[model samples]
Target: MKFSACLAALFGAVFVFLPAAAAPVDAGHARVELISERDAALPGETVYAALKMDLDDGWHVYWLNAGDAGLPPQVIAQPSSDIKAGAIGDIVWPLPHLLPVVEGEIMDYGYNHQVVFPFPITIPEDAMGPVTLDVVADYLICEDTCVPEQARVKLKLETDQAEANIREGELIGKWIAKSHVPFPGEARVLKKDLNWSLSLRLDGGFGKVRSIRFFPFGHDILHPAAQPVELGRHGATVSLSAADMTDVSKPLDGVVVIEQEDGARTGYEISAVEGPPLPDTSGLGPVGGVGIQVAAWKLILLAILGGLILNLMPCVLPVLSMKAFGMVSAVSSGHAGEVRRHGIWYTAGVLVSFGVLAAIIVALRAATGPITLGFQLQNAPVVAILALVMFAVGLWLMGMFELGTSLQNLGSGLADRDGDAGAFFTGVLAAVVGSPCVGPFLGAALGAVMGHSAPVVFTFFLAMGFGLALPFLVLSFVPNLYKLLPRPGKWMDTLKQFFAFPMFLTAAWLAKVLGDLAGSGAVAWTAAGAVAIAFAAWLWQREARLPRILAAVTLALTLFGVTERAMAPAPAIGASSAYAAKYEAEPWSASQVQSLIAEGRPIFIDFTASWCATCQVNKATTLKSKAVHDFFAANDVAFLVADFTRKDPAIAAELARHQRAGVPMYLWYPAGSDEPQVLPEILNQGLVTSLPVNP
Candidate 1:
């Protein structure tokens, strides 16, 4: 019996003393191992452990939220006998790089080459001997194809005699340090109609933040695309498009990554409170809020003042002659009440026109991204309609048709009733023609309104409309102002005839706007339409049935044909000689600007349009001056002209970036400074020459 027992004990001793095999047995595309920071640990102490993975070339593992596609790696740790681990802390992940998946279809955030995920292990006081732990790791490695991989890694940590492995501990320490720190501020999510606005209230703003990007922690919260981040002095707000699958009740967690112009990056983890009440978006609060209500009020005041100044611009001046004629005729006819009524009707016309314009802008902005003032004129069809209207108005003033008279007296006399209707239509005409002019102080106010909420934008427009009507409104109400006008006589006829020339000139200018939009083909059609309308007017003046019938038919056919051609897609600038000479500029692109900035070149960006009277004036008077041209050439400035004559979202965004509602926006970027110095709306030779030249 003793010999048999000795034989059993000898076999057991042999098996117990044999060396155990160390695991992390390699998988196909990745090598994952369970590693302990310390060789040993004392009882009742915490130890750090990591599941380290090294992937083969061209293979990557997903982040916690795999964005559009893929799955994240998983780790499950099991303790051996007599080894107790409290709970494994959450895995600490390093910052992930963005990976384009599916080539232009989807994007995924992930890591390649290597990743170390550190987890905590707890040892109970009663623990004895070596501590053994097993980690089961499952991960998907992806390149052209994805491969599901699993590895069982075992780690033995001696607890009886604690010993530290400095190298391994430092590696774990490095990974732990790479984890994202929590954002130091109050962050809340505010719902704005169909989208979400994330507001981060930092104490002192994001200093020198060139760009900010956000990554959500899960699906069904944010769109898997980038959003525009509007920065303020105190913080930043990012416009986030919500996914249809988002659960509004749940909180949002994400990372706010900021990159400097010099390419340095910093990241912070943020937890945003969901379901907050919508905040006030009126006035200037939407323009970077910053808790300053006064600033918004100031912007509104500026908008009103800007509108008052707009009437002085050359674009609106010609229309005022019609208003003056209506007032003089009413006073001479001994209808004093009609003057005030005309003013009221005209004011109403201006206000209603502005309201409709604002509503259209708001709707378009919601559907598309940023668009600018005079955006409607960018459409060739719209320009064509406006041109026809201008031509008809000119012809009417030239005695082609009589107002309020019988059709039989078509070309003989003016309207017999009060000119209130004419005054109202004139106001509407003024607003339409005045849209392309961005006068002094108007650019800043409108730019701020454009970047703000819908309510604020509309309010600013109303205020400006009021300012525009103020001058005429006062003139009608005050008898002293009207008495100064010359009495109605033969001179009135001469003056009226002379005014027709200006109307014709204005129509000719709109023809240029149409030409820029649709090329020479559209211009030719416009010229034909003009000829047809003039001939039809002459035929109508004959007071014969056959001529009038033929006139109506000719007018209808001309408009229908012109409308069809005007609505077609504009010919490419390179393919159109008229457009080539009209602009004479290189196409402006966002990427090209960035590339030039990267090369540290001084840049001069001129945001202009063919229809904008202010833009044309600045170009002819200041930009084309010999002194300004010479200075630009000597300074090695890259003269880039962004023609807003056509609708371009990129140019609109650039204008918004510089706080300009419309053109004649002149920007000067000195070498070594990314921030541009905006020149005045009305430029002079001194303004161009005074700019500092880079050595």
Candidate 2:
């Protein structure tokens, strides 16, 4: 039914175009007119030829590059014997919009107005007195269906001396400038398997660059309809993946036209230079390049290692220790059979928890479609919520009223009777607690899963779960290990309470994380929630019914408070570029840098960040060193720090053109080279000393 309706709409549009073709050429409906300058002067003197079309309300014409399916208006000028025409410039296109014609196809064209096409003519010196120039033009005019239209225009004038009209000259010049395409600035290129990354820097107005389109000029280099990855920011970074990057070594030059959202189009020829080699990713995958086979093996291995490491994490450690203590107590009581049963139950619990997590991940991935690395981490709300949740969990561990199995006791006393179920839940709780600590080994594994197909991702996750469960599983079966544990006594109670401190510490860390995610208000709310929970726990232990009611009420209120804060619009944390002066090429120009150096301006080019791990490492190590500090003080280089912590569009654009998308992009304009010399990603004191100085 949808297809039928679409076809009907298409036919209806085609019918509307028929009447426009036969419409008479007149002032009110459709008209063809000519505007020109005819004069006999020196060869270098300029002459103008213009053809204007006054179309009816719904009629339209095509631009220079009609795009997909339209014909451009062609002009043939009949010049006098002495007059000669230079290279015919491209037609100045008014703004164009993507018009959806058929269901699947779209045409980029313009509509509904009087449009003109102008060409320049040069007159030779010692020309005749009278000059008559004739023009023959052909245009394909369309409304829905199209019809070809032709017209002959002529103009005659006499010129013996020079004459100039300021208005006419300005009007012609304005149109000519509009017709000329703009030049593209610096660009950096990175090669991927299927695409060559071209990062461009747009100059001029912030909002002026609306959409960018790349025309390869060569065939089969890029696939048709290969969408550019849109990084929406003032200084946006776009990724263009070519069909193959093997052919490109250095910069690949091509025409790039940017169309403003407000309907202005500017064209430029862009060259994308080769960027720095990709960073070391040895442990990320195989020793060689990232291929399907290597990535799969790496995922499996990392998952197992990560799972094994989880047992040692603060969150999971307490739970595992409790299980060990439980077994020791059972064995000391001469309940060997009970110890064995508890071990089996605990293993079951861990496996079941893993199963549930796998199911959730699989289900979510299926429902949402392919779980790409970018997609999984893209949602800001989700990230915020996860951070908040982790923080809350951390606080709970820090000695807040014990959660988890406390509620299980209320349902039916069945929870109290079921040791197996308790063990299972403990396993589940371990997994939940371990989530925040992604750990070194797990990061690469998880990243690979995010980038790969579903089967590979699932396999890796399963392997990781197996590794995590292995230690607990082995302990459960090994009766010797259970016997080896210290006998239960008064000391067991002391040890149990001692283990709680780690939970409390974990909670404090989580609270700080919450502060980072939601700000000071969230941290304050967390403190209040902790207090309320503690009071509720005390009441529950004293008067069971009273505690239950209070616990319910407090939980409700706390959740409401947390939810309100979480849902609130995120407050801006960083400065915006809108207030700063547009980075003109004045201060950083070669001459300016040289002059500033001569004047003894202390220049400290800081390549800093808010989230770069390497930058943080550098800041803590070399950059903060006293020697480096004293050197800066002694030399008096002007300190200028560029902080690229958040989503800074200008910084991103600048980085993109330089073939960098990550932080720690440093440049020291020590007064020459026309361009700033980019610093290496890693920094050292020696490198700083080597920088050019005007001694």
TM-score of each: 0.66, 0.45
Best by lDDT: 1
- Tens-digit lDDT string for candidate 2 (1-695): 99999999999986533211122234333476655433233344666656667787667777655555667787666564223334333344543434334322333344457776667665545556645545556787777777788776654434565544344445555555555354434555555443444555445322434466665434324322323323221123344544443466546655565677676776565566777321111111111112233457867887888789867654466556656555565567666666666666766666665655556555543332112221211233333333444333334434444543565656765543455555665566565555434444663355345335556656775676677667766765677776677767888767656655555554565454444345677657666766665665555455467767877787678667665765454445433221111211122212233345545564544434432334545556666677676666676655455544333333433443343333455666554232456676567887776677542
lDDT of 1 by residue, 375-404 (tens): 878888778878887787788778886536
Off by over 4 Å in 1: 1-211, 214-294, 407-418, 451-453, 542-550, 574-586
What candidate 2 gets wrong by more than 4 Å, as runs, is 1-295, 310-422, 575-695
Least accurate 10 contiguous residues by lDDT in model 2: 280-289
lDDT (0 to 1) per candidate: 0.73, 0.51
- What is the model-wide C-alpha lDDT for candidate 1? 0.73
